[model samples]
Target: MSDQKASTRRIVVGVDGSGPSKAALQWAARQAELAGGVVEAVTAWEYPSFYGWGPAGFDFGDNAGAVLTQAIDEALGPDRRGEVRQVVVCGNPAAALLDASRGAELLVVGSRGHGGFTEALLGSVVQHVVQHAECPVVVIRGPAEATRG
Candidate 1:
């Protein structure tokens, strides 16, 4: 029983179709491989609520799952892509990642995301996760040279 428990390890990573997020996923995958853990690559999406107009103004046409999948594919490449499991949800990115972190050995996210300000050191989502994640969190940052390591 102890051996079985030890063999089962999970790592949660957030993806947003950004360069940093892709790097984060790569980093998490590398870490998972080293630690013998499974990687849960998650991406969150939320439709804008258009008050009045009978909801016709709002567009739910965007497919968040496809974006996330493309990010994963681009990061991992054709080979070894199956090592990571893709997950898509509807909510705030930080909250989604935090929720997924439950029962996970680690939670990984990019230092900054797509909508983050260039001058900012850390994005709001990263800041939120760092403050509130239930498990240990890893923030992936820097250039490709540094991130790939």
Candidate 2:
């Protein structure tokens, strides 16, 4: 029973197809491997908010799924990729990560300004999750060092 309970621990990670997000995923995967827990890689996409400017026939869900898969593959590589679980949500990134991280042992995310002011420290999603996540959150900033020890 204790063993079952231990393995049930999940480390949730938010991936946004960004370099910082990939670093977050890598860090989360290493942490999960070290702690004997599972890694849940999550990504979110929102429907086009423009009233009539949406694309003709593009499926955002599919695109999101592809992005998540690619991120996992690139971050974890082939040897460790199969160990992490993947999830895609259709909504705001911050809300989706928070919802998915419920009951998780840890929530990991990235912090790099995707756009806007270049001097900003944290991205909007990372800032929101850091403030509001139910679990302890780890924010990866800048590029991950070469194989962190």
Candidate 3:
């Protein structure tokens, strides 16, 4: 409804089934709960293009959706009860997050996701969104054990 949409703040978060991402999701959910907003969990993916040829039999979008669901279940527990909104986009991660963050109150992402980096900070997607997001951005830095899911 228009009333719900107008009253609810929209907090967008990037999820990739990784530790940092899960941490981001948890933070985003808590922020949304405190602010009476909805967390828009976004997951983006792209088909592998090898030499201009794509895979013959693969549903990348479906797989991405499944992964998103699992990540949500893992991060937020099983009974969300519609506390979060799930969004799956088929494109570049930064682009998807930027597009989803339009008119959003806040954009949240992990310091790094699914990357082999415990020493360095700021993954490419986080950097891009932080530099280019229209809304405010929050980068959650988890513990070293956050490398695992």
Best-fitting candidate, scored by lDDT: 3
TM-score of each: 0.78, 0.83, 0.85
Candidate 2 clashes: the total is 0
Model 3, residue pairs in steric clash: none
Assess candidate 1 and give its lDDT: 0.79
Query: Per-model C-alpha lDDT, please?
Result: 0.79, 0.82, 0.86
Give the per-residue lDDT digits (tens) of candidate 1, residues 25-49: 9999989998888888999987657
Off by over 4 Å in 2: 1-7, 51-55, 114-120, 144-149
Index of the highest-TM-score prediction: 3
Higher-lDDT candidate of 1 and 3 = 3
lDDT of 3 at 128: 92
lDDT of 3 at 56: 68
User: In candidate 3, what are the lDDT values of residues 1-149, reduced to their tens digit?
Assistant: 24654566899999988888889999999999888789999999986766246666668889899999999999889876447988999899999999988878999998744546545667789999999998899999866777754
Considering summed lDDT, which 10 consecutive residues are worst modelled in model 3? Answer: 112-121
lDDT order, best first, reads 3, 2, 1
